[model samples]
Target: MLLPRGVPEAGRLAAFNALVRGDRATVCRAAEVPLLDQVDLLWANGWQPDDVLHHTRVALADAKQRRLVPDLVAADRAGRSTQAIDPRWQQQLDDAGLGDAQARRGWLARWSAREGLEGAQLVLAVLAVVETLRVPPLDFLLPPPGRPDQPLASAASAPDRADPVLVRVRRLLAKAESTEFEAEAATYTAKAQELITRHAIDAALLAANRGRNGEAPTMIRVRVDPPYADIKNVLLNVVAAATRCRVVVLGQVSMTAVMGTASDLAAVEALYTSLLVQGQHALAETARSAPPGARTRSASYRSAFWLAYADRLGERLREVTDHVVAGSTDSDRLLPALQSQADALDAWVTERFGTLGTSPVRGGWDAAGWTQGRLAGDTAKLATGDLRPTRRAIG
Candidate 1:
């Protein structure tokens, strides 16, 4: 029987015969192998995780073809069985602290892809996972081939300045805010966001996975003007989270230091800038339409409206982000990488800010304005901030 260096050959022969005989239950015990041995055992048998599952499916199909349920074979060996492969897949998933299959797949695919597994290594990996899952026929649920993550901005992408995508989005937002017709403005701003997102994801996917150095972490400082700067920071958080960036508010100077790969920083920077412009316009429109009943508290009403709008926007952005991260195949690496990058950013921020603090925002609590703000936020140009761009924005 084929075996790797140092792998015991004692009961492996029985495990091998059991494998070929489609007696997974017998092999489960006879193989009595450590969970780690599962992959090596599969390799000795010239099988893969996909093959293991496929083999089971074929055997079941053949049995169904012959109109019979296959008989079970008990293990003839006394090998000690370790963790049950199938149930343990769920256990490893829980150990990783992921919520569901989609999220767990995201974590594994992303981290493994980052390491650039291929050929034999990749096959063994997927197979090792198969042993853990233990449900032979269920291997079809294994994750799809993972793609590398979006790289950090590098000199290759841009020449010591802003990315063209960022510039383009900024231009579109500027046009959107400056234009008179609401429909035309929405179209421009929406397109800008779509373009930037596409540019970021596409560039990451098309590049060679090996020897990629574009993931160097970096920072960008974004300005937040006062009179509701705290609220602005919340809005910035929305963009930052969506773009895979971490934000630190510079309380004293009304500035935000965003940290992430350059590609992400560009997206966060431009998206926040555009959103700020759109938000500014929306707030002004809401404030202008306020009736005289709250005349003395008009300023408070404006502040209230802004705060309320930020609250609504934050909720919406969080929902959108969660959905995207969960559903995306490309995000497997990004999901974990984001956490690591965030930790790095937190360390960087802590060194400077020491003890971070929050400011109290003044009134702007007009119910009418708050309602209008919710409507505005929900119907914003890029609704879920999804990966693909919408064909056109609603007027």
Candidate 2:
């Protein structure tokens, strides 16, 4: 039973007692039917394997519930033919460890034996997972994978494949995230920003030259988990802004829906991920030097620090993007193409999430932390130059 909110303790206990008295084997078998059905419903409603698993882990905060989800998803997917499965969708399933585990014929028994689950524990896990799968309709961020009428080729082919620009940028950002020295990290990050901005410009121009019938805009949901999720959302928002993307923060679910062309979305994801790593590192370093009296409010300090960092980095990244765009040899064409893309994307967002209300951020702030974070952001390198259009791109 999915416990409706605000159910009194006595009512809750009664439901639990009823479940406790049920025959365990029958319950498990019966539960699987609904669980598989819910998985199918969610897939159609735009919930992916990773998104559902993440919701279970964060919203439910139950390890048993989380463990049961992959098996349920994989088992449901087992019935679908390989040709019907999009490669990108398969990759998501693989990322969640659902690949190569589709042997669902005896999954219930195998899962029980593997986890040593039994009796009430097993029943609770099954029921919890079932309830978790009953997710409300979500906007189809990516095209639903198994739809017979939809074109899966575009979703499965070029967009999801490894693009050279992204591969190079990922390597640069990886160095930025791993390096200990602030200057070294900043240089790598700056280089990455330069590359991404240039690539975006080239892509836009190429699309324009091709009569603007290039890859259409799309969406991806990035998890902005808590321990200061609001501040982290700000960081993600800024990254999206600089990369010609828009983000709608779904604070209730600890997720952000980012909409953009595929390449730009990839850039935003990669850059935001690296920046978060760098921000956390800076937070730890600053924590070490905090005054003894101020240590009690570490949460406030971190919140302030990240907020300031996001604001400053937003300004810096935008500056780099502007500089690169201004220097483009094909600005006459590039500016209009970029503006047209932005307009189309704005219209799409308006249609998709009409009349969204702003969610107020709940947190404390520290002036000292803000100062430190601004300094960190100011010191971070973001160099860009020489944006002549490549012959290969335009030709």
Q: What shift in Å separates residue 171 of candidate 2 from its native position after superposition?
A: 1.4
All candidates' lDDT scores?
0.49, 0.75
Regions of candidate 1 where Cα sits further than 4 Å from its true position: 1-162, 181-191, 198-208, 211-214, 287-297, 315-327, 351-359, 380-395
Candidate 2 has its poorest 10 consecutive residues by lDDT at 386-395
Cα error of candidate 2 at position 229, Å: 1.4
User: Lowest summed lDDT over 10 consecutive residues: which window, candidate 1?
Assistant: 68-77
Which candidate's lDDT is highest?
A: 2
**Per-residue lDDT tens digits of candidate 2, residues 1-395?**
43344799988777666656666555556566666777778877777777887887787776656767777777877877554776667788777875234654566656766787777787777777776566666776445556756532124223443778788788888877877777666666766777888988888899999997455777778998878898898899899999989989864566889988888888899999999989988887866766776652477777888889899899888878887898899999999989899998888788888977777666787898888788777765454433222221211
Output candidate 2 Cα RMSD. 5.0
Model 2 scores a TM of: 0.84
Total clashes for model 2: 0
- What does candidate 1's lDDT look like per residue over 1-395, in tens digits? 12233556766555444455543333333223333244344423322233333334333323221111000101100111332344323342334322122211133333234446433443344344443334322111122112123232222222224566667766776776776655456556556655655554554444324424235556656667666777778778877776667777643334566776676777677667766777778766654765666542366655656666667666655555555455557776654444554565566556644777666655546666676666656654444443233344422
